[model samples]
Target: MIEILNPTLLTRAAGTGALVADILHTLKGRSTAGTNLLDIDRWAKAMITEAGALSCYVDYAPSFGRGPFGHYICTAVNDAVLHGRPRDYALADGDLLTLDLAVSKGGVAADAAVSFLVGDGEHPESVAMINATERALAAGIAAAKPGARIGDLSHAIGTVLSEAGYAVNTQFGGHGIGSTMHQDPHVANTGRPGRGYELRPGLLLALEPWVMADTAELVTDADGWTLRSATGCRTAHSEHTIAITADGADILTLPKHMRP
Candidate 1:
């Protein structure tokens, strides 16, 4: 369902957005070698509780996933891109990891994802993958504005990925997000402009641009969760929740220090 936030709820959305951003920044800082995936989940749970927010993913269940997610955060590492279920694994130096989170506070919800290298390994391939996703995410956000169709945003993102020489996967892409986590208006990573849903004030959308280095296919892990690249290529994902306002599109999930 698509939702338009009222003035008061939009204000709350700001708070929710800031909280999600801060928590993610904290996680990135605290993560290091030997850190367990579950540790990050617990940290997210604690911070969320302290902020009086509810995790949207803990009980998330869609046909594509195994069942209830039952996790505080999605910890996708290396080849793992989506539906990463935390387990007993210690992070090693230079491990690429992605953290996707969604939380609701004061009746409004915000969702975001970030991918980064774990340790001091300067793997050019991994570094490029992460940078490309971030660049694509920026392009997608730049294309989002009042009256712009969903296709515009998709096209902007796809252009970056295609130019970067990576294949786009549609199994999962961006989507509408509001009072709940996922919403209507599935925004594909690749599409032509001037099509799909039209933008309007008060609408919230989570625009994520993700890509695998050399493949568009996905394989599910044996654990009933975690989607990996079919060719075992490195992956990257970046996202931000944006609110459609009369002024323009206001990005909600930005790191406190990243004002740009």
Candidate 2:
């Protein structure tokens, strides 16, 4: 379903978005060498509960996944990318970690993700991949505005990834998000400009740009949730929840201090 949030709902969305961003920022700070993935999940749960918010992922059961997600957040490390289910594993130095989070508060939901290296390990390739995704995400956000087509954002995102020499994977990409976590219209990572759904004020979209180092193919882990690169190459993902407005696209998922 596509939801055009009203003014009040948009205010609530900003609150939820800030919470999601703050939680991610805290988690990223806590994640380091020897940190267990399950601990990160626990931290997320505590923060969400303290904020009186609901986790969109815990009860998320879709055809693609094994069952209810049963987790507070997604912890993707190294080769793992999307739908990364927290497991019993300690992170190592230089491990690329991607934390994707979605939460609802005051009847509105916001989603975002960030990929960064853990500890003091210099992995140039991993650093480059993370930077590329961040740049692509910025490009996608820049292309979003009232009257802009979804394809414009996708094309902008794809252009960055392609120029960075990374293969684009469309199997899973950004989507409309509002009261619920995932909604329509589906925003692919790559598409032709001037095509697809046209943007309008009050529309909320989660624009994510992710890429694997070598190939576009993905393999599901035995856990039936975590998606990894087929070539086991490092990957990165960046995302933000944006609200379409008269002036332009307002990024809802930036930290409170970072917001204007």
Q: Which candidate achieves the best TM-score against the true structure?
A: 2
TM-scores for candidates 1 onward, in order: 0.98, 0.99
Can you give the lDDT of residue 62 in candidate 2?
95
Candidate models: Cα lDDT each: 0.91, 0.95
RMSD to native for every prediction?
1.0, 0.7
Worst 10 residues of 2 by lDDT: 251-260
| Pairs with steric clashes in candidate 1 | 94-119
- Writing each residue's lDDT as its tens digit, candidate 1 over 1-260 gives 77888889889998899899999999999889899999999999999999889999889988888889899999999989987899989999999999999999999889999999998878899889889999998898888888999999999999999999998998799999878888999999999999999999999999999888889999999877899999888788998999888767889999889856
Candidate 2: global Cα-lDDT?
A: 0.95
